[model samples]
Target: MTKKRKSRGRSKGGKGRSDYVECSNCGSRVPRDKAKKVTQRVSLVEPTLARELSQKGAYIPVSYVTKYYCISCAVHYGVVKVRAREDRRTSYNS
Candidate 1:
């Protein structure tokens, strides 16, 4: 068998098994290591109100939202880009 990616499309290295997570968009079950996780910080207050409060020395609260996407959904939503044959074999962090 031939390998398409060096990591086999999963971040679990030397681990036997990994947990599964549901995709936020399609609601499909995908492995935690294989799924793409995105975290965004959302402001509780509106931009205008937050600005006003900041001037008054009021602290604005923000919430963190995390989303997981499968490979198909990740590609569809432009979260991850398709790599070339050579690029697939190399790690971007290296």
Candidate 2:
């Protein structure tokens, strides 16, 4: 049978198994490198309030939230899109 998808790369010097991470949306286990990682800033204060505070020279606390999604969830959430045969080989930068 012919290959369905293009190979990412050769694992020439890799170890046996890889580390896994839990998908934030579906709670499924996915390989760390294969998972889609997303980082978002969560603000403790409301956006309007935070803007007012900032204008007043007040500090607003924000937290960086990181989430990982499996391939299924990533596609479902529009994080990635199905590409054409020619576009499939292109790599994307976050």
Candidate 3:
């Protein structure tokens, strides 16, 4: 059988494998490079209360929450959107 050409921009030389991370929504293992990462800031105090406290010279601490999603989960959750035909990259030569 003949070898199939790589459709993506990746070259077909190396091991082609990568580290994996668990998807936050589906719990599926996805390659680290392929997973979508989202980081959100979490505040210990409510915004209104924090504003009042800050006006009174109080400080509020914030933490960052990071989540990873697989391609399917990301698409389903709106993290990734389907692009129109014209908007898609035209790397493949027909």
lDDT for position 21 in model 3 = 90
Q: What is the per-residue lDDT of model 3 for residues 9-92, given as tens digits with 9 covering 90 to 100?
A: 222236578778999998999877667888989999999999999999987899999999887888899876765655444322
Instruction: Score every model by TM-score.
Output: 0.88, 0.82, 0.73
User: On a 0 to 1 TM-score scale, where does candidate 3 land against the true structure?
Assistant: 0.73
Best-to-worst order by lDDT is: 1, 2, 3
For candidate 3, give the lDDT of residue 90: 39
Off by over 4 Å in 1: 92-94
The CA lDDT of each predicted structure is: 0.93, 0.78, 0.73
Q: Per the 3 Å backbone cut-off, how many clashing residue pairs does candidate 2 have? A: 0
Worst 10 residues of 2 by lDDT: 4-13
Whole-structure CA lDDT of model 1: 0.93
**lDDT (Cα, tens digit) per residue for candidate 1, span 1-94:** 8999999898898999888999999999999999999998999999999999999999898999999999999999998889899988976557
Candidate 2 CA-lDDT value = 0.78
Q: Which tens-of-lDDT digit does each residue in 10-41 have in candidate 2?
A: 12225656789999999999877778889999
Model 3 segments beyond 4 Å from truth? 1-15, 90-94
After aligning candidate 3 to the native by TM-score, how far in Å is the CA of 40 from where it should be?
Answer: 0.6
